[model samples]
Target: MGAEVLADKVYCYPFQKVVTGYLNKYPTPLEKNVTAVTTVEEQTDPATGIVYRRRIATCNNIIPSFLRKSREWIFKWSILKVTNIYLEEESWLDMKARVMNLKCRCLTWAQYASMNEESVYRESKHNSNWTEFSQKGTITITGAGYLNCILERFAQTFLKQGARKSIAIMEKILEEKYGSPVS
Candidate 1:
């Protein structure tokens, strides 16, 4: 078993603007951990016109130094020696429906653990000028035999923190691109 998180938030901007901001938010000073982002694949559904995109983000390793003290574990898993980690994101945008869905997961440490996240942005039910955003994340550590419990907790916290950071980045991007908040 692992930790799971769920959250809901409202972006003051309308769905269109919010989605635009979300897509453009990257390489910002506020989030230095993410070094670069590249779009690897893109396709458009001929019938529904939904746009699908796959992107990979290269990020500076965020693992705490204390975790590195596990020399034997690190030695055993030589893959952990790398300095940068990769995150894969797939997003589907339904232009007519005004919704965006995304799934992001870890690619660098998949052997040792699994961190998967799903998120969505849609027109707010109450206000057309606002967007509703929700996300869920789950983290499970498989390689860390006994310390799995503690490591899972740490990873869960990290996952939530990453989500919060993205929200902040989106807010800033919206403000800069579209000016003042709608409401």
Candidate 2:
């Protein structure tokens, strides 16, 4: 089984400012689960003037109590690794990320559970002063033998709940930093 999520939001801030905020959003109170962020690579394409960045962020495990013990045994931690491509000329940013269990070299369950997400940000067509952000993601659970179906359902539920909370908190942060949309 597979699950997908789509979210769209308009920010009053200009595209540049919105991009800045997104790059600096990790340390905010809304994302306390994130423990650290490290930039692994960065470069600019001379031909197209596009920028590429790769980052790895570590997050504390926040799984359900029932899964905590198993999670701890199979995975030492959770890490999100992402690559972002920015096209300033087009005022667009694209991101692809993978959420994985750290230290899972010899693990079975950990290999079956993973999360992949992709997102895009663009200057609003309605107004250049506003930015539009959209995200689409999928969560998958497989290779768990007989428990695959149950695990997939659990992952879907967990991700849905987390996404709702995170979006609410992120909106509040954006409002505080850029002020509410002039609507």
Candidate 3:
């Protein structure tokens, strides 16, 4: 097979200098990776065109925990969670367009934080016991019946063997007494 052309070059295989020169022009290439959840609504208005119409609403406020290179290429390691979630629908047409605009442009820590937060201090429907501790940061669990909440919320990700073993022992006791299923 004939050599490939570098941006429609006369030479069969452009030299490294030519290829590098071309790459230098762009500097940074874009990487498109996003996720989002959207909802749709329908409305009826006699003042407008038809009697019925659909509206799309969107939310675009997610904190991203990642690195950017040259402001063009982005490398995301984790997705952050947005503690506050809100949506607004103005007009019928605006709503329709907004719904389709819902998109996740970056990863957020919401899921991971939820899991970790749940495991650290949990509350349950039965018992009412709360605990407070500080590991990587200061954590204050609310009043009684919080242990259950932690267990249900977070997952353990320890590196040391002894730490894992200790957690396992504690988990076993919790499982025996609470009889709550592991997620």
Which of the numbered candidates is closest to the native, going by highest lDDT?
1
What's the TM-score of each model vs. the native?
Answer: 0.94, 0.71, 0.17
Q: What lDDT score goes with residue 181 in model 3?
A: 34
Tens-place lDDT per residue, model 3, 8-113, is: 1121121222222222221112111112223354455555432222222233433333321222212133222334333222222222221111111112333323
Give candidates' CA RMSD values in order. Answer: 1.5, 8.3, 27.3
Off by over 4 Å in 1: 73-75
* Positional deviation of residue 87's Cα in model 3 after best superposition, in angstroms: 4.8
lDDT of 2 by residue, 1-183 (tens): 766666677767676666766667675667677656566666666765566666665655554555544443333442112122111111223322211111101012345565665666677778877777666656666554555566567766766775676567666767888787654
| Whole-model lDDT, model 1 | 0.88
Worst 10 residues of 2 by lDDT: 98-107
Output the TM-score of candidate 3: 0.17
Clashes of each: 0, 0, 35
Cα lDDT of model 3 overall?
Answer: 0.25
**What C-alpha lDDT do the candidate models reach, one value each?**
0.88, 0.55, 0.25
Judging by TM-score against the true structure, name the best candidate. 1
**Model 2 whole-model lDDT (C-alpha atoms):** 0.55
